[model samples]
Target: MPQATKLSAPTAAPTPALPVRGQTDHLRLIAEMTREFTASHDYQTIAHSALERITRYIGAEAASLFLLTDNGETLACSACYGPVDITGLRISAKTGVVGRAVQTREGSMVRDVSEDADFGASVDAKTGFTTRSLLVAPLNIGQDCLGAIEIINRVDGDGLFEADDLVLLETLARAAALAINNYRLTEQIVQQERERHELELAAEIQRDLLPQPSSREFPIHGINIPARSVSGDFFDIMTLPDGRIWFNVGDVSGKGMNAALLMAKTSSLFRCLAKSAEHPGQLLNAINSELCETNSRGMFVTMVGGLFDPATGRLTLTNAGHEPPLHFDLRTERFTPIPADGPPLGIMPGIAGSDGYAVTEIDLAGGMLYVFTDGLTEATTFGGGMLGIDGARALIRDHAEESPDIRLKSISGAVKLPGQSLRDDLTLLVVEDMMTARAASMPPPRLEAMSTDGEILRLRVPARPDRLKLIRAAVEQAAKYCEATEAWTFDLTMAVDEACQNIIRHAYGNRPDAGDIVVDFIRRGDCMEVHLMDFAEPVDPSKVKSRDLSEVRPGGLGVHLIKSVCDEAQFVPPPPGIGNLFKLTKRLPSKLQ
Candidate 1:
């Protein structure tokens, strides 16, 4: 054996002096090596294959491949084919002959390691292998140093690396750089796909926690739109077992996955606690305490909650540092805000500086209560202008006369307009009182001849405030004729009086000259039914809201009283030619039955 000789020593010039046949043979071998580099995508496989190809081409005994880490501070040996296994080793990208090649973006050759200043003896010192001639090439792509490849002690031909070897190794390193970069890009794409799938699942779970819009008893409707894959805002409305409706809207402090998780927790706590809680304040107190204890992220919630009693037409509400709700007044055709009275949830437990959560009551005479998160008010227009409080009020007023369904659609459409970007989650809820509304929009009574078979009493009186006495008296007499109890008679009379007064005052707008108010007392199979009709201007159903009874109010208690006394009190829209038809049905006891 010729000592397994390599071609010349590393002291050779840039272009080696070689015979025509040898130079041609080197070119053919390099073409085959380039094909190997383009064939594989596995990083380790590519690095291992490059090391074997480069070492064999230069007739060297050992080789190693190092790649830069993501942080760019160090290079990690990804593969090795040498006397000692140095795989998985890490070093600074500023270290030995490999570092010099990477730093200068060129290749280097050392004829003798003992005489070379850049030779790092750490590898040889550990492996106890004597070093001699070697070649180093930087794995570079577009001026970026990915890493380097090194070939050690030549064992063939002249036992040294030549200038020709330098040229071949540098070319091979360029191809290896591309393969590494491709593998890195593929890993990044896979990671992003996994995160996207998780967000979608979170969005579904959040939507399931929401209460569906299917309550006709309260005529409640709303919509929620998220700025991202998940939302930080939510609205909930549930009719309690006791015929009372509880509704609330909340906004978390942030957006994305973290905010979505917090929103779900807040909403779940509300649904669980609101079932047994009596007042809006009590519900808020329990919810605030629960959230403060488990909330480690320090995120807070701004919320507005309300309880509506359809029987009494009373709405009790609590606002916890949230945007004020827009009150659409049908009488005045204006919008008023229900301001917040306490701080937001998770802002330090119980109401700050106050004894407890302050409850605000409103006797919805005939108006709509519109509640929403700040996302609606803070939304930006195409011109980059915010839809401030005033803008929100104006928008609600514009659709004040619309039905709940249309109103919700219009609001959602305005907030999520085409080509406009949403910066936060949006939520809106609307509650309306249609009884008072139907009374104000009375038409003339349709009097052809209702079956008089069970007619107990019938009276046609002038629609005047003074004649309310006659209406009540007639109702009391009819109750007595039907053998009704004292309690039944009193409640019927009072309920009849309220219905007539609401007609004379609100329906006719206190104009006695409007028309006659028809009062009919009919006895059905097992109940007493009274039908009253008044001719007046048709009222917008969305404008009627009962007055708040907690306050020392002088008037507006008539509708609340009638609804409380009558088992079934509803404003029947006049059929065709009829005015506002007010029907009050009360079940009679066995004696009257």
Candidate 2:
């Protein structure tokens, strides 16, 4: 057996396999290069670092990155690794595996590359090294193929390149693709932000062009404070023929610019239709329908429209879900608030409550009629309580005598002194005195059929524009005593204080519960006579001027003042069909010389 062992051909020791344990650490270090490259804003730093990492990780004898030109067919080396020269390695994408990988969108391998027919000889001739192996990967992102990465002549002994070596080189290609992608995305974001800034600036300019609220004035006041940069509260008053004051007050739901836009539109519509000779009910209905057609945003307006009738001391009103109005009767010191009868505007279409709305007839007497947006009452009190309609009415009662300008200022001061923001737009409008309205269209009074019958005490009270408080107190006192005040004069002209109280006591024989009285005015040959008819027992004319003047008392003194100053005082009693009535007379005061 020993002799049979033939000497085999001497075999070379197998090439020692390279140690690859620390290779993972080298990979992490290489991965970090891409992270740093992408993080950098400067192109030079990114290019320099990417080249250094490639040369170290692959142990390349010489390596260089050629950045593709816009045409993708040609590339100029950007970062280089080698001792030969600092100038870049230049290449055309069509010449080598670098070109083939870019064109095919895949990796390429070369072993014994000089033997391959398609391999180029120029890079080999310049570097003066026989290329043993080569690895190449396209550095493409999506359809954009950006040249390729190539490593040549590995430092370690090798046959065909190891599978892991090809993998590591391909991984490096992906990082390069991502870095290029990041730069393009950042540029796009910057462009978009600039456009957004331009739009915001334009919006600011439009906000400034609209009118600021504190600038207008008129017979009927307007207030349009805003809850935000803009709001929905709006009020407008326009004068019409024959001493009629046409006015509109409303509040729209919601806030800010949309609300402001709608308010502007509604106010403009009112002004355009201000001259429409329609009844207030009809007018409001028309406005509601128009707004409903255009108010597609589901917003509504609570409004109050008024047509002032000065001659009749009446105001015809139509309500649209607004708060009830506070009416102060100057003749009785009493308040009668007209309530809501219609829904908020723009709720339904042509069918609206404003059409079926009954006109509220009110007498402003000597006191002003204060109409306001709910914002005033709905405001927060300093105590963190809500100031409701009662609070607003009380404030009006306190300032009923002040002029509209002064009263409005008072309201502003009271709210602001407590450091409160008027959260909603608060507004107030006033009609100072309703009496001086043109009364010329009124027909002359026809005197009651002369009863040449009994004694009748008549009193004629003129419109007391200045004596609101006095007039109200007297009317209330007479009501408590159950006496009716009439409209006749003891004199040819008015003697309000004397005649009113006098007729209240004398006509009904000072009966506290007397019913209503009628005053008839008759003018014959410059002598105007007032007649009052009643069903109470007939009065004695001889005793009509006599009253017990013994002691000063609060009760009977009103009659004494009446007879002393008035031209005639007659008390009518006990007529078959008529109830108690009073006759009063007055002469116009002459101008002093």
> Which candidate gets the maximum lDDT versus the true structure?
1
Candidate 1 residues 235-321, lDDT tens each? 898888877889999999988888999999999999999998989988998898898888877789999999987655569999998
Cα error of candidate 2 at position 220, Å? 2.6
TM-score of 1: 0.66
How high is the CA lDDT of each candidate model? 0.76, 0.59
How close is every model to the real structure, measured as TM-score?
0.66, 0.45
Model 2 TM-score, all chains together? 0.45
Work out candidate 2's RMSD over C-alphas: 19.6
lDDT tens per residue, model 2, 282-326: 777777778888897788888888887545556778788887777
How far off is residue 434 in model 1, in Å? 4.6
**Candidate 1 runs further than 4 Å off:** 1-42, 45-62, 79-88, 123-133, 155-160, 215-218, 276-278, 294-298, 347-356, 381-384, 434-593
Q: Which candidate is the best by TM-score?
A: 1
